[model samples]
Target chain A: MLEQYRICQTTGLRVFQSTENLIKANAVVAVIFLAIGGLFGLSIALTRWKAVHLLPADWFYLALTAHGLDVLVVWIVFFEIAVLYFASSVILGCRIATPRWAWAAFALMLIGALVTNVAVLMGNSSVMFTSYVPLKADPSFYVGIILFAVGTLIACFVFFGTLVIAKQEKTYEGSVPLVTFGATVAAIIAVFTLASGAIILIPTLLWSMGYISHIDTLMYRTVWWGFGHSSQQINVAAHISIWYLISAVVLGAKPLSEKVSRFAFLLYVLFLQLASAHHLLVDPGISSTWKVFNTSYAIYLAVLGSMIHGLTVPGQIEAAQRKKGYNNGMFEWLRKAPWGNPAFSGMFISLILFGFLGGISGVVMGVEQINLIIHNTIYVPGHFHATVVAGTTLAFMAVTYLLVPLIFRRALILPGWAKAQPYLFGLGVAGISVFMMGAGTLGVPRRHWDISQADAILPYDFPGAANLMMGLNGMSAILAALGGFMFIVVVVGSILFGKKIDASTEVPIAPPEDARVVGEYGNEDHPAIPGTIALVGVFFVSFILYYFVNWKYLAEVWPLR
Target chain B: MSVSPPQQKIWWNEPVPKSELIWVIIAFIWGLIMFFAMVWWHIYGEQNLSNESYRITAEDFSAKTEAMVEKYKVREESGYPVVHPPPGEDIYLIARLWQWWPILELEKGQSYRLHLSSLDWMHGFSLQPVNINVQVHPDYEMVLTITPDSAGEFGIICNEYCGIGHHLMLGRMYVVDERGN
Candidate 1:
């Protein structure tokens, strides 16, 4: 099996045949789920639109539950597993340890995902993602999630095993690549996240089966968010790693200061999971001290970590572009960047949108007082759509374009559509996020199948603006669905029907110009990243502006006595 | 045919540039500032949820809420309890599957202790237009004081996903003048 492994000509990284197969399998499954989840998403969006109100109440909740699980847990985690294999075995040139075990994990995950989906579709498990106890679902729903988490837990262990094997095999000298280190952080956090899920979910599963008498709702929320919000922390770490990887692969970008970058990753490991407490900020039975501690003091350290990455990713790209002599004025390097390449353009857009939309709103929503207004509103979803969909999903989609030629050994089928996919998806998602948040600020309730509440005993009305915003959210969802459709077509077509190529013989799918593939990570320390410095200033201004705007909004509400 | 990752020393722990350190420090300061600002708001500013919640059995709480509603029962409108207890009195609100009970009628500018609890699943007290929201869970009575600054009919929408009729879980709060219009 080791003999079957070959060096990727495009990336010059080792690719174990078995590991490649696993990665391909996981990536395909992820895409399938993305399609399924995207369909459910479109239905929910239309249903909430008030004008269209697509699905009836029962189907709406069912779709919403499926949408949450498939997209948030299944799709992203599957892709992250692929990413883990790629980062570990492939990047470090080590054969994946226990390939048989990896397959078992994959099988477990697939079966678990299907079981959960079937349960939801069967109409017994419309309990939604945060299946708060007492409002019980089918036992199989909890069991499915448990099985999936256990499978992922094993996959994470496999990833760690690959790292240890690489170390013992002496595949590379010194520390692992920054991207690998970041993945390691994600893997470590995933252990904690999965464990939390198991801790609460096992009992909940028992409760669903009448084995347990009761589960405390508050305790359930506390621990559930430990699983729920921290899952996104996994995304944060994984997607940010991809950010580093993309900049390097696409532009030969080196971090401005590798030590500073590593420190940020360290900060993530130390503090990121604590931000999960933001979910319980407005919950009863928790102390103000705990809420304040989690939301403010400790959480800020995590925010700092993200802020550092927000600066350094673009900083690295600017440094690389300047080295290539695009260093005229401030943003000439940005302007001259390969806008046509989906990989670079997509990653860059993910970074920017994630920062401005997701990052800003997240901090505001986490603030204890500020959260009172937006907690459980559509604003909550709005913030996450920016982070998860626009940020992580977009990054994953972008990387898939790169993975096609490198791993699948096939050219992208529709290069033009691939090029347009990022902008369309990003723009539409941005619209969805902005419009939803706008509606939420206007006091539009979330998770409502009918925003009009037409069948209610007593008729009440939302401001006309809320209706308009929901209508726009529907329109944006259509645009996003189109983008999602194009992506599926491109990915599926490329994999199954596009022109196959020997990547070694031919230049693999528009390799980065003057590919300055550095011999070592952090070896190419440049003198200046001045353009990045300017950009960070702009980001700071935006962050301050958004933060104050929320405060102003909060203040405008009737003063608390 | 060769497949080997290259030996590369000093991958991490490289010397940080002065500029990067400066930005990190600046971020830390900004964060510190925000943290302190929140503390100030919680303490002195007009943004504090009443720190007056107590754990209770869902049954016990609901029974107490029923007694309170019966005591303050001003009228029965549309098969729902409408209560207007005295000013500054403890006001009881029950969140069930699809409604917040006892349409509250409060006097404007008179502080009232608004006690909220859920009888079944979790619900959210999202007082719209005013835009104050809090999660109302079973087994805990969440108490928040409110003196309505502007008198009007404020709709209370359950923001938390309860069930199929979570959307229809709407309650109204009428804050009229002292004359009880």
Candidate 2:
């Protein structure tokens, strides 16, 4: 039993051996998938750039299908599973429940991912991620996805089981840690997301195998997005959890109000999944009332939840900084922050970009009327790249900087590169998001081999600016790929060849003195966080302006009803 | 803080920060406003998408489109019909594997009930230059009462990925002045 547990010297949390190994396995595999998916993404971006035109039409579609599966589904889900384990066992100082079952979950997920990749590469399953019915992929493709979803479902159970174990053993006092609570929210959302996946994909599998004669196309889209869009909701919950964890671990920041933050998470549990309706806003067979109600998340309660998080995350950070004597002015705390630390810089950047770009654009386009201009355009991808890539992916990348040192027990190799990685990647992805949105606004189609309409019998010439946007997007993707390569190298190199850490190894940064006392309330005084409030004020202004701008654009379009 | 258990035994009873409380109230109000704005748009905005749709077979939809084409096709553009249906009549646009068949001609400022459905896989009805888009799915006939505010030659691009040759799937619409240019 002694051998089953080891105390982490850096944070002093008791890490369960099985849990650590599971995290390592999941994280390493997640990175491998990121590399594969990133490569596919790069090729697709190049092909979209008319000047480059890197891949043939068939290959472009193939690359797109692979890219969506590997990145959107595989890479993010794998990483999220790791986060679940970490938040449960590692943070709670309890042994992971059913370690053997956890291992099986990992194996099943790995196999499923590989099978799907094989199916995609076989040149038959190029149905683009939605795989909307009549356009069938190989039977194996659906089988792989179903298996993967099942594995994820099992992992979510394991997380729940671990939570129960922590409670039974009385791992700590009071409620579970806020990070654990947030993780619980993510796990609950994941269960719902995977159930939706099963509901649709099982029939899709049958249809692909010719066991079913026909599948309703509109029905497939409506149900698939329950799986599709909600999967990103899982990302939102998981990444927000990471945002809290990073703020706590790196800056010793406490939630400004735990009640508010946790309530926001609860809102996610209740209403976030309704965002699936956002995709169907422009589709037929759905009522405007259903679309309006569901797309706004039952009166935008979920948006309110996000708004609360947006304020509290930075608010807590500001409060923490002020307590450390950076209270000279509203801007001093931010100006004097540890910008050189990749963990802090990456988290901050993720917060700002996700709010401004992802959060704002998502709400703007999700409007029932406004969706007509943006649905299925490259703008849709642009909006998500901001949310998933710049927002969730960047936050994930930020946490990895800390995870390497804490879990891997190795100093991050290439310190300078690690510091620069987030900024480089963030800038590149932001460019991709902005430029793609610009092109999309100019009526550029997504998932097309050629926006130039080169081979069309009746070609429509896009504005010169649209071509410029694609070229810029291609360049930005290359830059992001380089940043991604640096991250992989730093992480993998550290795991293999960097100096190993022991109990006596000196950690460069220390938590705030109060944080050293486990289970203690660190921010009892509740220092005023004027800086964060001002920042959030700016965010609100921008969001309002952008929302109205879209409404203005909608008014300009030809009248329709 | 988050990595550890709450300092208070019962965190729910903790006092809410005035600032956070204020912000939450503000956010909730904003959310309500955003929701009402969409509802407001449906009543006041002219560009709202109609929920008017019916379930029709692919074969049935094709037959209606072909009948309209035979009746109103004045010319052929690249093997597809250049259909000039009278204003206020129902116009049929069929989406298929790789094309949006039957080029449409309409007078400016005229309202027509436009019908869109796919004969095969799902497609996107992306009318460019004015840049309006809607999803086109098989067996679901989506109808829209559209009045072209600006008259010109407009292009319909399939934004949704149907398969390989998706980019080549283009259809045209010519909105002429009263003189019928």
Candidate 3:
């Protein structure tokens, strides 16, 4: 029998209980947002393939707006909040600072999401959520942005409160637990992210209402991207934390190096927050110098961190399988790995897909000149979908199978199906990504209601290719939708109809008994803080300080009027 | 299709296990091949533009003469609009959403390449008769090589939003034959 960790209760409250509930609540919301996003994407595919604007151009724009907010903003961010809470409270062996405040924060974000979604559906603001300047929308959209920001900021505060209390309580030993450590870093960035939102979005909102006559698009774009790009990093950082979680759950493993993993995560805090200039690479106003520094060099730091994780992941699998007594050649452990484990398969495939379609494209597209051709192409969304949707979102889904029984206190309703959802979604996503690459390469632009309409001005033979790609997109999207729906059924059914699992019978993953190994991070005695991240942090902050002081001109003309 | 499993083998029931080195080597080779394929495609594809033209518009084309024509009111053998712009000539064409502005007005047997660009924001410029979708970016130009394979009133609509009047940004391209050709 495995030695299960006891879920101790204090004052009639389970420490892990609240975080699990929070995660489940957020996941349900993620699923709903996912469904809405998937539907809109399907419509887009239909519009392109069938060459019919099933919805009007206005509604399609509305759908596009809702899709961005719901999937990119609501879906991912909300899930991050849940993941953060879990990382802080349960994974760190600490409790939420005030569970009430956390719950209240969730409610606030939920309400904000509702308000924004309703406003979008009403066509009050189809400004693409980006709400780029000069192209104005109604006051409600801006208000929705403020409300959402406030909600997210408050949630960050709750996380901060939790972290401080956990620190005082000394929940874990010297270094923070890996998951909590990562979540804390993301929460830290959230402060800057939220502040940037206020800096730009609030003033822009005021400008929209004519409170202030005008705000330059250039100035607004910079600060807004401070919020925008940094928020994406938060998503990515949070995603990496989930990678650890999934590895442990699916493979019964731990990260290869505790210090190295933490270092990678911490690098995100220092470097990635300033890498927002990547998006503005092709924008006319920003200087090539700023673009080069921000897009290429700064981005490489995050990529390096990811690379560390990538290598470390395989290292972990090797170590874990070695523990399983696979004593053959170096690669024999890999051969013995639990390939049938759906979560494991999902993680590997997601890693591969994200690395190629997401990471490589992120670097390539960030190039200033290259972005001129592909900035507004469908490729942008394609890249994000690989990282956010394929990588992080799927990783979280994989974790649910392990977490549901522990958190919900029930076994998965259909464990078999739970196992299959990951690969199905992965395959479906890969197919969609491959198809979209075709559209993007040909410069088939994004945000379209109908391709046939555009085909009118294009040469006669071009629509055939575009339409063919769209058809592939449509097919893959439908497959993804089906996969998504299957996940919903499995997840929701697990929560509702699952068999009761006794808390006393939890499965435990402990280091094997054969060999007593020394911790590499601990100086043969205790855990050591890796120097890489701290050193990088110093350089990143110094670079930012230098740039802000010297290149004040970039702040003004970045976004263009 | 999935690999069929036999026995209780750890990774498929093969006695002679596949080497990881093999996988890595194959991956490397595949990467190289894909890189070369892409480079070849990009270089060769752009250079071989049989439909290349500086400007083909609605004012300078006629079917009666084999030489370069100066009026769009001409039909080609395929029976469609042919608006050929002579070298060094700049022209502006007005169009609404959801309609095609044919360079050759109801002229059939036409095959011509047209340069499309939107005046403001983003617009989808397509020449029916020939299935082409060239994005009429506000500032950048897109080339469309269209040979109207058939005759019909091919409709056009704005794929991207210009403004509230976006839906009515429709145009029509009529493919018809000329009397002489």
Candidate 4:
């Protein structure tokens, strides 16, 4: 049993060999897919840019399909599986449950991703990620997705099993670590998400192969969103978990109120899935009542959950910094933070952009009536690129800087490039999100091969500014692609050839102290988080102003019922 | 503290911080306001999506649209019918693979029960300039009562991708004044 585990020199955690191997395998495959997806994303962006219409129509659609699947589903989910295993087994100090079965799951996911990519490249499955039925893709496309979903489902069970093993072995004291708890929440959401995938994709698969006669378009959309949007919900949970984990590791920060944080996660498990309604708000065959209720997630309790997290995460960091005597001014804690560390910089940028751009725009367009103005527009993609790419993807990239050293046991190569990577990627994605939203507000369509309407029988000219937005978006995509390339090169090169950590290796951050009873704060009632409070105050004010501005925009649109 | 197990044996009994508690309360109230605002908009706001939809066959919707085009046809432009339907009438619009068939002309400030559906695949009824977008599905008829408040030539672009030719899918809506200019 002792031989199965090696004590990590930096953190002093017992790392099981089997679990480490699985995480390494998953992370490596995820990076490979990220490279592929990032390339496709750059191509599509260039195609959309009227100044440089890169790909022809057919190839553009095919690239779109491949891009969405690879990045949104394959890359994120693979990394998440790695996250799930690490959170449950490593954090809890237990062996992974069924290591061989976990390997089988990995194999299935890898094969599935490859098959789907091949099918999409075969040119028949040019249907966008939604794959709305009656516009059928090749049968293998559906099969590949099903295989991937099943593998993910198995991985979720492995997570749960590891949790059970941790409990049975009495690995920890009272409660699981907050990061593991968050991962538990992610795993629970993943189970529901994958089940929804099976419920819709199986029938869609049968229909594609002529086994079933027809699938109602509305029904397909309704159920498919249960899979599609809920999958993003999973990303939210996982990434938020990483947020807490990164803050804790990098700054030794603890949540102000464990009860509040845990309750927030509980809210996500209960109400986040209802976000599927955001996609269907402007669609037919659903009632306004259903849309309002579901989109709001029962009076926006889920949003409240996010709001709480938004405050508490940075609040924790501020409190920690102040404890270290950086409380000279309101922004001193933030200014004194480890800006040179890619982990801290990446995570911080992600937090800011996700809240301001992604969170605000999401609520605005998610309003039932307001959806009519921006649904299916480039604004939709703009909103998600902020959340998924700038927010979640950047956070993931940030954590990689830490993980490569800890798990891969190799010094991160190109430290200079690594430090700058988050800014480049985050700013580029932010530009993409903001500009796309601007163009979409001017009524630019998303997923179109050309915005210029060059081949239209009766072309309608968009405003001159909309063309400029696409051009800017194209440039931003290139910047983001460059950042993505840096990440891939740094991560791959570090793992393959960078200096290995040994007894002589210099560990920058001090090893964390052993867990001990946390004493009450100096006040015992009010925590000194003035900086976080001030920041959150700014967030609330911006949220209110932006939200009402959208409502004002809604008021100007043509009256409808 | 998040990466390692909790230091407290019973963290459930940990004292809640005033800062976090206050923030949660504020957030909860804001959430309530956002929820009620949607409901308020439904009651008082002029703009809202209609819940009126029916299960429609593609062929049936297509035939109805053809009939409306034939009845309301004023002229032909670029091989498509230019339809000028009467105000407040139940007008049909067909969304197909590469076009929003039968370009529509209506008077500004007049309401129309615009019935929209697809013939072959799902498409988006994205009326530009005005920027009123809605999802159109095959086998489903969406009835939207819209009042075009401004006079202009509005473009209908398919935002939902149908195929390789999706970008070329264009339709037009001309909202003129009482002068019909």
Candidate 5:
């Protein structure tokens, strides 16, 4: 197996053929689901917009169910499996152990994904994403999810096996790369997430089959969100790792401080799981003490972890830029940086949007008192879209741009469109998040098919501003759909029809040569990059202002004594 | 660009950057402050949801809510009951499929302990205009002490997805002036 592994000539990294094949397979499936999920997302946005009302009631629910499963579960998890494999085998310069088991995992995932989607499309499981108890769906629905989670669990185990192989092989000298360490964090979280899913979904399957008489609603919500919210936490770790990997692989940027960064990852393992408490903040069964303790005490540590990543990722980039002699003014380094590279631009956009829109809003909404205002509103979706779509999905798209040329040995088709696609997509997603949050602030419900409620026995009308904001949401969704469409076209076209490149003599996409100068731990050799410091200051100010604004908004919500 | 693999360094024992370390410390301090602030708000904030909740069966709560509605039956309309309970008392609101039962009428500037429970599935007690949202779950009664500051008709929409008619699940609360008209 060691003899069969070959070095990727372009990047000079070891690539096991089985790992390469698995990466290609999972990434391709992930993209296909992204395309399908984006279609369902577009339909959902249109239906919720109220003016268009594209899908009928039943179809609206169906599309919503599919959109959640396809995007949130299938697309993200499949891509993450690819990331796990790459980080383990390729980055560690080790041949993947148990290639047969890896194949079995992939096949199980594929079958599970297809089974779940078919079940959803069959119109039997319109329980939406949470699938709260007593609103039972078909038995196939539970089976589909259980199978999918089991497959992902197997994949996570396979990832762990490869890590053991890498350790035995002594692929790297002192330590695994920071990106691999971050993926390890993600894989660990995935095991926890998948196990939580089994705990809830197995009994759920039994109940759907009448094996169990009743599934306690409160218990189901508490346990199920352990699975649901932790899945997003996995995304957070994975995408942040991608951010680090892209900065290193694309810009040759080094971690400003590896020790602090690794500590942040450690914080994620200990405290980030507490964020599942934010979902339960407004629930009746939970006590205030539990809610406050989990949401504030444990959750803020997780926020601290994100805040560290927020500062260091860009700080590393800025230091690298300055080292390249771009350090002239407050922003000379930033201005001179590579803006045309899709990978770099997409990642930078993801960082900014994730911090400002997603990160800030998340902390605000997680507050126990303020949560009463927006828990089940469109604001919930708004925050997650910022994190998941803007942060994770966009980051994934950015890396896929690199993975195409690097892993597929093909040059990207439509380079110009690829460069512009990130901006277009980022802008559209930003609009959707903002407009949705604005509408939610005006008391717009989240999962309602129509805000108008025109067909109700007693008709009701939302505020005119809500109507207008939703209309803007509709327009933004269209723009985002176009961007999504462009992404699919670019990636699929590149994979299918792009020109092949000779890796032996040429590397088309290249980073700055001396950018990856990671100094020793606690080394204070690098000068302070003033621009990053200033930018971080600005981020802090924005966070403070937004947080206070929410408190003020909560203050104004009819002073209840 | 020369494509070379990055040199692997000590993973766990890397030296920390002074600035990043400072930032981490500041972040930790900020998190602590935010935690304390949450404690402060829950204690002192006027907009806090009720901490006076207790567990109860769905059937028992429904029966109690029915008794209250019968005791304070102001009118009946369209197979639904409308109860106008007096101010400064325990107000019962039952959430069922596609409607919040017994539209409650109250007086402005008066606090009422509003007990909310679900009959079949989970529902969201979303009071619009006021912009207060809380989850209504079956088998557990949630108590919210609310004071209507303004005299107007506020809509109570079930924000949770209950079933096909979740959108239609609407209730109204009338906060009236001193005349109680």
Candidate 6:
């Protein structure tokens, strides 16, 4: 009788009341913010394509500002938070830590998002979102940043509190659950992320308040990016964790090298703290040696983590299929795996595309000599689109389609379209990225509203090789925009109107005593193999958003016109 | 709680077995190889480490536009004279927050290396089509060398967002392959 009560409107997550439904509802809300960022991607491309830099100087800076904060910072981080919550609360079999606090965090973030959006739209925070002074903006913009950071910090505290409780209760022991492990690592990184924010936001606020005499532009840029770059790694770890969850959700498969994967995630936590220095490689204030080491060693370590996953995830997939008795040729496992499983297939395709273009391009962009050509150019944007926008964010979107309904006991609405969105964004962003690479080769700089009049090298008159590429970037954004709209519909519809199903009995609904170590449950026959893995699906991470600055990634000549 | 309790001792929690000690050693050795390889390329890598240096509007293009602006109400900090071509330099190169002019200029026979850089927010000093660029922080030093083998006007553009005027940051270098005496 008690089990049956779990299925009713009073207790079950029938769209809204239950924690599961509430969590999915929050995810849908966050997606709206990400969509705006996605749209800005196209706007930027079009601005460059027409060589118009089109929006008025102020409006252009506003859009550029929103594009950076909204898309780059907010989109990925919020999505990561949502997914992390779902993984911890439902997937790991725990009640969300203080459902009220979670809602408060959401409210604070939502309000912050609104305030910042309005401020930017009104041209109050047009300092390119970097808060680099000499370029001033209204005070509200700085306030908005502070509020947002506060909300995020509160969310982190809430997450940490729950994990501590989970560990003390000893729900399970030995090794932490792989998804939880990955999340814990991301939370660990959040300590640095919040610390870095305090470093940047506090000073910026001081400057905004006129409480400080000066905010040295060079020092500010360096420290800000330290916070900036490391946060991306957080996005990365979470995305990988989701991939692990996705494989389990769809295929009942676990990772190939449990120890190796967990170690790699921990590497991100230990190393990425200092890797933020890579963003300042070209800045003159820092020494060349510092730049070289930070770029090559620090950033590369994180990049190596991606490389490992790139190789390992597929290897596990292959091995799993093989174990399942698909004894065909080398590529047969690829064909045999369920492409129809939205999370698994979508994440797989996103991975392949990002590996060559986003990952390697990011590595190249971080190099001392190579950073010169690409920094702050369309190429800079292109590189990141592949990484953050295309790579991390897309993974999350895909995973959400599967996890959301499952958590809420709602059947997916338009599961077919849910599957299609990934391919669309992947293709569109690919086109955009290639176009940006061409522009980088041709020398088109980023962050300009219009290039049309008598301009400089990437002159409004003639953009050279980048001319065609910029236009192509616009087309890519447009295509991706369409895909983004479809994503909104599918995700929102799944949570709101889809038919309801009972949360699986096989799937645990209560928070386990321990989530630190992952092991199989039930039956010695299968023994769940004590299978430990971190293969993920539906983790939405983004590459394009990270490229919003283009300043660190590109370099331009002195004013020519 | 309807959910089954998690199993004990997951694979990830297990300590490395003795058999894998050799693998760790091999991994260490491989890491050393990779690190050294990158260092070798970095310290003495074969790249287009060569470039040419020339100023735009080098007294030669000295368009009277130099007088285009009203006489300064005051002298700038350099005190090099509120004069157009500051003493000791034959060029009146005017670069705004984000762009440069006359991207190319060179003597046909004279071999020269351009010391390129920025004077503000990290600007990109790049020669398009070739991966020759670097960040030019204001108060930072930059050195670029280019040996123009032939006579021609090459395009130069800023690839960084020094400011809103970033896209217009363009410069040129014309190699007078053989500057007649």
The candidates' DockQ values read 0.50, 0.81, 0.04, 0.81, 0.55, 0.21
Backbone clashes in model 4: 0
Task: Give residue A540's lDDT in candidate 4 (0 to 100).
Answer: 95
True contacts kept of 2: 0.90
Clashing pairs in model 4, backbone N/Cα/C closer than 3 A: none
Native interface contact recovery, all models: 0.50, 0.90, 0.01, 0.89, 0.59, 0.23
Ranking by TM-score: 2, 4, 5, 1, 6, 3
Best by lDDT: 2
lDDT of 6 by residue, B50-165 (tens): 22222222232234224422332123322222222211223333334755532334454333333443334456665544445555544333334344445544545665555566
- Which candidate do you rate higher for TM-score, 1 or 4? 4
The lDDT of each candidate is 0.86, 0.90, 0.59, 0.90, 0.85, 0.59
Residue A88 of model 2 has an lDDT of: 95
| Tens-digit lDDT string for candidate 5 (A368-452) | 9899899899998998999999999999999999899878878889999998999999999999999999988988999888878
lDDT comparison, 4 vs 6, better candidate: 4
TM-score, cand. 3 vs. native: 0.71
User: What is the C-alpha lDDT profile of model 1 across A286-309, one tens digit per residue?
Assistant: 877788888763838988998899
Candidate 6 residue-wise lDDT, A116-202, digit = tens = 888788865667756665456677777777777777777777777666655675544545567887887888887788788778878
What TM-score does structure 5 among the candidates reach?
Answer: 0.97
In what order do the candidates fall by lDDT, top score first? 2, 4, 1, 5, 6, 3
Each candidate structure's TM-score, on Cα atoms with residue i matched to residue i, is 0.97, 0.98, 0.71, 0.98, 0.97, 0.80
The digit string of per-residue lDDT tens for model 1 on B1-181 reads 0012213255344556677888999999999988887888887778677667898877888888788888887887778888888998988899998988878888887888888899888998899788988999888898888878788888888888888889899888888888468
Shift in Å, residue B12, candidate 5: 5.4
User: How good is the docking of model 6, by CAPRI class?
Assistant: incorrect
Which pairs clash inside model 1? Answer: none
- lDDT for model 4: 0.90
Going through the candidates in the order shown, the clash numbers are 0, 0, 51, 0, 4, 104
Superposed on the true chain A, the predicted chain A of model 2 yields a TM-score of: 0.98
